[model samples]
Every structure is written in C-alpha cells, then in structure tokens.
Target: MPSVDEIRGRIEAALPGARVTVEDLTGGGDHFRCEIVSDRFRGLSRVERHKLVYAIFGDEIGGPIHALSLKTLAPEEAK
Candidate 1:
C-alpha cells in the first residue's frame, strides 16, 4: 500500500519544481486524488499530461494503487 506522502514524493520527483497534492480519498492507501501543477505540463494535451503522470506509477496503477483521480494543470492554469 502506497502512502499519500509516498505518492506525492513520486510525482514531485518525476516533475521537478511541480506542486503536487495527494489525498487518500477513501481513507485507503490504494485510492487517491492528485492535483499537480507544473511547467512541464504547459502546452501538453490533457491526455499527454495524464500519461506522463501515469508513467511514473507504472505497474502500480492497477495493482497496489487501485484508483487515481487526477487534476493536472500547467503553472498558468493553477489557481
């Protein structure tokens, strides 16, 4: 089971200088919601941004991490 902080770390590491927030949606480590803001996402399509984030998790996505709801934004899109 991956902890929220662990997930946040992975995302932050993958997107250097990104602002990431991870929430354990169901009080379970496997279910999560992530909000990511990064300059790397600038000009990328939504699918492309998602794919980038998903790649960091690899096999863990449908396995240990059962569900991940993502809100990805470029720096300018962030509030």
Candidate 2:
C-alpha cells in the first residue's frame, strides 16, 4: 500500500507545477482520492486527464493500491 504523500509525490513529479491533493480514503493506505489541477491537463478530455494520473501508478492501481478516485482538472477549470 502506498502512502498519501507517496502518491502525491508521484503525481507532482509526473506533472510538475500541478496542484495535487491525495487522501487515503480507507486509512489502510490502499484506497485513495486525489484532486489534481494543472496546465498539463488543458485541452485534454476527462478520461485523458485521468489516464495521465493513472499512468503514474501503472500496475499499482490494482495491486497494492486498490482504488484511486481521481478528480483531474485543467487550471482554467479549477475553482
């Protein structure tokens, strides 16, 4: 299981300058909910934006990390 900070770090590393917030929803460190806002997401569809984030985890999504609920947005879409 990945820690919240570990997840946040990976996202931040993958998308530099992104504003990322990650939480361990289950307290067991497996389930996570993350909101990411970045210029990198601009012009991308919702699924595309999610794919960018999901790519950061790869096989971990269904392995150590059970679930990752994402709310990804471009800078202009954030409020």
Candidate 3:
C-alpha cells in the first residue's frame, strides 16, 4: 500500500509540470481516484492521457495500486 505522498512524488518526478490530487476511494490503499493536470498532456488523446500516468506506475498499477479513476487535464484545461 503506497501512501498518497509516495504516489505524488512518483508522478511529480515523472512529469515535472504535473499537479496531482489522489484519494483513497475505497477506504483501502488500493482503490484510488486522481485528478492530474500537466503541461505534458497538451494535445494528447484521452487514452494517451491515461497512458502517461499508467507509464509512471509501471508494475504498481495492478500490484499495489489496483485501480486509479483518473481525470487528466492539460494545464490550460485546469485553469
């Protein structure tokens, strides 16, 4: 079970301009929802947007973090 701070660190490290808000949706550490905003997401498709985030987790997507309901936005969309 990864802490929110650890998840935040990984996302921020992988995507320098990212702003992330993560919540444990099921009272457990596995199920989560995240709102992510990044300049790196600009012009990307919805699948691509999620893929960027998934790439960061690598094996953790199904190992530690079971589900991540995500809302990914470009920086301009965030504002």
Top-lDDT candidate index: 1
Candidate 2 TM-score versus the reference: 0.97
Model 1 worst lDDT window (10 residues): 20-29
Ranking by TM-score: 1, 2, 3
TM-score of 3: 0.91
lDDT of each: 0.95, 0.92, 0.89
On TM-score, the stronger of 1 and 3 is 1
lDDT of 3 by residue, 1-79 (tens): 9888888888889989689998888877898888999988999998999998999999999888999899999988986
Error of 2 at 37 (Å): 0.3
Residue 66 lDDT, candidate 2, scale 0-100:
91
**Which digits, one per residue and each the tens of the lDDT, describe model 2 over residues 1-79?**
7899999999999999999999899899999999999999999999999988889999998999999999998988899
**Poorest stretch of ten by lDDT in candidate 2:** 48-57
Clashes of 1: 0
Measured with C-alpha atoms, the lDDT of residue 54 in candidate 3 is 95
**Order of all candidates by lDDT, from best down to worst?**
1, 2, 3
Instruction: Name the runs in model 1 displaced over 4 angstroms.
Output: none
